[model samples]
Target chain A: MSLSIRHSWFEATARQRLAGLLDPGSFCEFLPPAVAQPSPHLAQLDLPGAFDDGVVVGAGQLGSRQVLVAAQEGQFMGGAVGEIHGAKIVGLLRRAVAERPAAVLFLIDSGGVRLHEANAGLIAISEIMRAVLDARAAGVPVVALVGGSCGAFGGMGIVAKLCSAVVMSEEGRLALSGPEVIETVAGVEEFDAKDRALVWRVTGGKHRYLMDDCAALVDDDIAAFRRGSIELLDDWQETPDTLARLRAKQARLQGRLSAYGRCRDGLEIWAALGISEPERVPLLDCDELIALKEGLPT
Target chain B: MEKLEFKFPSQALLAAAPPALCGVVGSGNLEILVRSGVDRQICEISVNTSARGFGETWRAVLATFAASQAVGGTSIAINDMGATPAVVSLRLAQALADYRGGAQ
Candidate 1:
């Protein structure tokens, strides 16, 4: 409960993160494990099912403001999205649109869709994306926090990008295709899964923050994430999704592609951004990195 | 996957006891969901596990748990992914302690 004691966000479970992020005794879980239904599909494949379907969705107080929260449990099936899992998130987003909470904090830690429930999982992810966009369009801020073991990959990566803002720790990764999957399909020569340094450089939060993908970056501490969330809420302004805003985002994406499309590594991309010592970027602390980004030309 | 059920006699729980959940149904792990409003004299447990042919092990674990904890008028559901007997015993104690509003 004391913010002074460092609590590693990456090590904490989904429930534990919720307890640490929200005010004490403020969390009221939507589908507590006791009554919530587990995935029906897992049983057909003789797999164990988790109550709450590996995702915890509920309403809670963040600082003094009421917020809706959902955290994916990476320990279970890599926090893969299933029919029930995606539905819970969609339900929370829908509630956000109606209730218009201070914000919707999505603690994303999933590796994407559940492979066992392949097609169903894909469909569920699509529905969740739609619900997230719908919530944002209705002037509800959907903020994503990424600092878990699984990180955010596959469909969930897209969902995180669709949010109003994203907060990430250096250990948090955000990418579409995971490294292992890429290596499996494209061969290790293309993207070696065993190359830990390369993997982090490509998908980790520092790269994302420098590229202007994530709105904020913090340490791997739960208290830091809580502080980041509170700061975002304090600076919150209702910017409903619109055609013009989407076009602007698309233009920024096009600019990034044109600028560094041929860069093979994260260091190259940072060098192109005019960082004199791109290799040293990783050694910089959170404050130092943010200061460096500020000094860079837009 | 296999489903197993067991019941044991123990002391009754208070009527207003809150439900508690412990652990996650991960590989080599299990989750225990405990709720009150069951038969006052019996503690019922149901297990849905990925590991088959381990009913006897489950029975022994639950029997020991029931003997140790006053968990009557409660129902427990366990979703297990091949957790060992020791892990099961630990989770059962933690779940019961959590149910009784004690530190986990």
Candidate 2:
């Protein structure tokens, strides 16, 4: 099949994916690129200005309901979030509350933030976390979509976990620290960073779905992803009791810390989750996997 | 300490400006920011990297980048850490490419 830019995995930019998700002519972009605001530090270094800070944050209509969408351009520094990037996200989310949109959809595909501006990125993430909680407090259901190559990591991974509903594609991989770092810490004998299979087994969607980190898993196609997202959005108007759910999930995460502290493998989590065939867990298809076990809502 | 090296790629002769920038800021990773430069007619690129002394390397990469893409007056900026040369090049090019076209 011919490859379309809109579906070109990592090569395809954020706007391309959003175009596919929303109806043509329905998307009204906010903060177009003409408004270039670079950090003073970046300018001091003679650095080029960031276009949209690698993220496209705005509002668009998915159908009849006007939804707020934040799609990351993975092409731009792996769609990382910086100060302005994070600010735009949180600011728009507040707008969602006031506007009373049907739902909030996040197309997360980032390694997290730019290290050059580490302070700015960190602050943005903190603000974003606050916004996520604020959205919940305001009775807005937040949904996370992780189907891009970046998959969400670092601080963004924690934000994804906080979302009310999460839809992960088969290719989705989520983790706080990437495997390469783990290998650096554990040594190659303990872990190999280049091993694709090993990496997936450790952090791929299949593992997260079975472990209940991800609520649903679908195909990589944007249509499929969009449909799954819209499905969750169906209940967007009726916000979930997000704080209680978060409290419960928070307890579970804390439980992971206490029960399986620093155990970093799919098999380990599978065993902890009581799967008899820890080895077979990774190989199971979606249907069989779902039948194999029920998951905790995150 | 052993330092890491990488390159950020971006080129657009006649392109639009970027709206924002972001990325993770870990030891081996980095986030970049891009947008319109002082001039809207020239495709510009800026890189903030932890691995110093790669100034020539960045220039070479950026020079080649300028030659590769037909950029309109556009400015580029990047803030990075010790990312691999591959990731830097990919992010820069990706961001610039998105500026010309729509981001996926």
Best by lDDT: 1
> TM-score for the second chain in candidate 1?
0.92
What are the lDDT scores of the predictions, listed in order?
0.91, 0.70
Collision pairs in model 1: none
Indicate the TM-score of model 1: 0.95
Report, to 2 decimal places, the DockQ of model 2. Answer: 0.09
What does the lDDT come to for candidate 1?
0.91
TM-scores of the models, in the order given: 0.95, 0.68
- Expressed as tens digits, the lDDT of each residue in A159-185 for candidate 1 is 999898999999999999999999999
Candidate 2 lDDT over B1-104, as tens digits, reads: 11233333334445444454434433455555555555444555656666767877777766776677655465555556567777767766766655656533
